[model samples]
Target: MSLGGETAKATIAKFAMAAVGFFGSILFARELGPKAFGGYYLLFSVTKLADRPLMGWATASKKQFADNETKRRELVGAQFLFNAVWILIATAIGLLLADRFRSYSGIAMAPFLFVVLLVSESNYEAFDRVLTASGRVGLSTWTDALRSYLTLPLQVFFVFVLTGYAADGMVYGLVGATVFTFPVIFYYIGTRPAVPSVDTFFSLAQYARYSIPTDFFATLYNRLDVILLGMLLLPAAAANYEIAAQLTAPATFVATLAGSGLMPRVSRLRAEGKTVGQEVTNTIAFSSIFAVPIFFGALAIPRALVVTVYGPEYTLGVSLLAGIADTVYFRRRQRH
Candidate 1:
């Protein structure tokens, strides 16, 4: 598909996912209240940090898969092996450190649930990257949408309908959604793993050498604040901060979606010996159109938007919205 077509589908999928996520966040916040929700967010942030180590492999896989069609299956096999080993090692370490994680996050299920979350998140990310790298951008977007849509109802059932799960219910729902969606993702990708050669491992590792540090610092930059808040302050503070961050997330979607579609296109264009200067310029220009307005809009109504969307219980985060919005805007610009 053309970049425009892929971007349009991604935009639509993002709209749907954002709408679902907006409602779901409200429900989760109201239902669990600030303290519980904060703990959940903290646990999630920790898992995101844990997952970062594997991100280099996923990043390398995307570039390699896009550029080297002949080696796609071997790349897939290598990535799968690498991810499996990482998950096993990470999960074991997490289980061994369960007590510390539990004490810090104040979530009783942190130890057990963290492993499930890590596995699910790792696999889902790998599958999504494969789809995008293979130029199934629209399909990949819908696949993500599928997971988001599935997660909400399951979360509602686990958190609201069932008894005693509480914030842990959110984790359960997410894992369930991932389990249900994997087969669909597998079917679409349609490539069985081949035996990866020694060179496949070397190539992936060489690329990951650069990608790992980039992924590591980026994940830390994004999640470190939440992690620090969870450690140093009340869970409610972390919860409030997370709510503000979530509310401002949409501001960067245009740039994020553009980049998603741009990468594969650029890879192909470069392979074809075509100049991509105009394409990059046009994408950056197009992204600024929405990002700038969202930044200002957030600045204009930070207080009202917070109390209205997330309830007065979250009013403490009102001061945070504009700053987060500005960060989102700058991050989008920096990304381009």
Candidate 2:
């Protein structure tokens, strides 16, 4: 497929995934109610917050893979080691403080869930970066789509249909979805080799010099509000903020798909003595096709969109949604 076609495919798949997430969010909100669901959202958000550094490693891995296909295994192995260390350390800490964390977030099975979440998230993030860098854009998007769409059905079965606990249900569903999608990822990347050498680790870590701070700030910027609202305000407030964020996810996903497709092509173009500046220009133009409409639409009908999609209690976040769209717009415009 052409780049435009690929972008559209990824974007449409992401929109479908977002719809699945939207539905799941509604179920979570309605079934658990705002307070409990807020606590659960906070728990998950904090887990993602902690994983930012590891996620930076994954982002760096993408760039490294794009830059040098020969180093794919070494890059994958190094990141595997990075995530393994993080998983072990985080699990230990979460186990020791599980009760305290659970009390604060009202998330059940906190320690066990954290371990599972970290493992699943690490695998998914690593898989995504590798897929995108390898130029398997379709597969990359599909893996993410599988996780997003499959989790909702599994959660529904466990959370409401089978009368299981909502938090456990969501966590289990996430694990299951990631596991279900793992074989394709594993097939693509193959197994991690033996533990890489110290030199290999450092080389991989070097790439993260750029990714680390960027990922950290981006993760914190995205989640700090949710975290603060959960901690300092009501859980319902946190839930509302999450709803607003989710509402803006498509625009962000568009930029992500474009960037993911762009980098490898950019690297390849440069190698072929082609003008990468033109490619970057083309990508921004393509992404803006979606970004511009979404931004203006959000500004025009934020309340209608929020209320119609997420129900009335969330209408208070319409302004937040508009602000998020503005952020999305500026970020896309400034992206290289």
Q: What ranges in model 1 sit over 4 Å off? A: none
lDDT of 1 by residue, 1-336 (tens): 677677778878888999999899999998888988998889888888888768778888888888888998898888789989999999999999999888877888899989999999888877677778876777888888999999999999999899689889999999999999987887887778888999999999998999888888988998888998987887888999989988877776666777876877788889989998877886787677667887898889899888988889999899988888898888777776
Weakest lDDT window of 10 consecutive positions for candidate 2: 188-197
Each prediction's Cα RMSD? 1.4, 2.4
Measured against the true structure, the TM-scores of the candidates, in listed sequence, are: 0.96, 0.89
Model 2 Cα lDDT, one tens digit per residue, 1-336? 356667778887888888888888877876776667777788788788778788888887777777776667777778778888888888888888888777767776777787888888777776677777766776778778987878888888888877857777888888888888877777876646456668767877887887888888888887887888877877788777778777777777766787778877777778778887766776767766666788888899988888887778776678788888898788877874
Cα lDDT, model 1, residue 107: 88
C-alpha lDDT (0 to 100) for residue 116 of candidate 2: 85
Q: Count the clashes in each prediction.
A: 0, 0
